[model samples]
Target: MKRTTGQLAVVIAALVAGSATAQDMSKIVNTPHNMANLDVWGVVIPENQVCLPCHTPHNARAVEDGASQILWNHALTEQTFEMYTTAAGHQGGQPEGTSKLCLSCHDGATAIDDFGGNEDTFDNVMIPADRLSNMGTDLRDDHPIGIEYPPPDLTGYNDKSTFTGVKVVTINGVDRVECASCHTAHDNSYGKFLRQTMEGSALCVECHDK
Candidate 1:
């Protein structure tokens, strides 16, 4: 079959996008070379089961709170976090969606090895208390999640038109900001595992008006 110029261009664009995605996936930190017995924390499991700690094909949908369909191999966090708030406009709520998945390890509540519905046999790996990555349950000091951005209105959030520019990922059909918005859970091409560079506050400027 002969293809039109537009169709050829679309195919080329898709190939390029796929190549970029594959490249980024290769650079992610979840590889066996990076996570397999690396000198990270004493609590980490020494096994070479890299992605097994967080994902699985079957039985992932067996878990609760709509976690199974996402291939969530890890256990959900049981702790309730102290959520974020602004002095004037506060809309944050309890952790949900991907943010909850991140807290599965980062909140310092759940064990890293406690996944695949088998925490007993797994090594007693956990993010340490001293590490900055251990965000704990209290989030009043951290950037906000589980909240809606200011709506397009006149009196309340009308002044902050630039908020629309901040990156966001939709979950359950609602445009919400989750931890994955700013950070990559698996990718670390950015030195700090951030999704983008922070030089000159470029990442911050993506959402903030200033």
Candidate 2:
């Protein structure tokens, strides 16, 4: 793959930015993200390596446009999405940051065995269409991702700092909500890898005043 000077610069920038964040490997063995434990995809990762399906220590694959890097080992999704838009004119745009990484498997576009440069012989083996985890590419029905958080008016939304469980990702100096905001990939104690329990709408109210 030939990369222009600008593209190389972007990749370098992403590498630097990605290296700053810590990788949380705790509690993933019990989660669905533990591909080796599932064995449904027919990919035999040596020694039941739970992290290899999504991450690698060296030579991780670069995502589309080199937007962000996180030792990403899985094949990225190329599905064009119908983004979410709110009645108040808030646009979710395309998936960004960790959201894109999550979609690598969840979108049902990239095969489950399509990591580590392996041929995708099990292309049919993907997240089941009926499952809620298989969000597919049509994101219009889901909560908005890649959207600026704490709307300019701050109407019906709590201050970003008030969020104790969920988090917002900063993209290009602007704080935005991504999948990681609500879902902590390494931890699933709350179920669904949610940063906090949704019981009594607790997670929803973390950022939403309603």
lDDT of each: 0.68, 0.80
Best by TM-score, which number? 2
lDDT of 1 by residue, 125-174 (tens): 76879989789999998988875644333134323334432356565666
What TM-score would you give candidate 1 relative to the actual structure? 0.72
lDDT of 2 by residue, 93-125 (tens): 777777888898889777777787566454446
Q: Which candidate is the best by lDDT?
A: 2
Candidate 2, poorest ten consecutive residues by summed lDDT: 18-27
> Model 1, poorest ten-residue lDDT window?
151-160
| Every model's TM-score | 0.72, 0.81
Give candidate 1 misplaced runs (Cα > 4 Å): 1-26, 29-34, 37-47, 61-68, 150-166
What is the TM-score of candidate 2?
Answer: 0.81
Off by over 4 Å in 2: 1-26, 64-67, 120-124
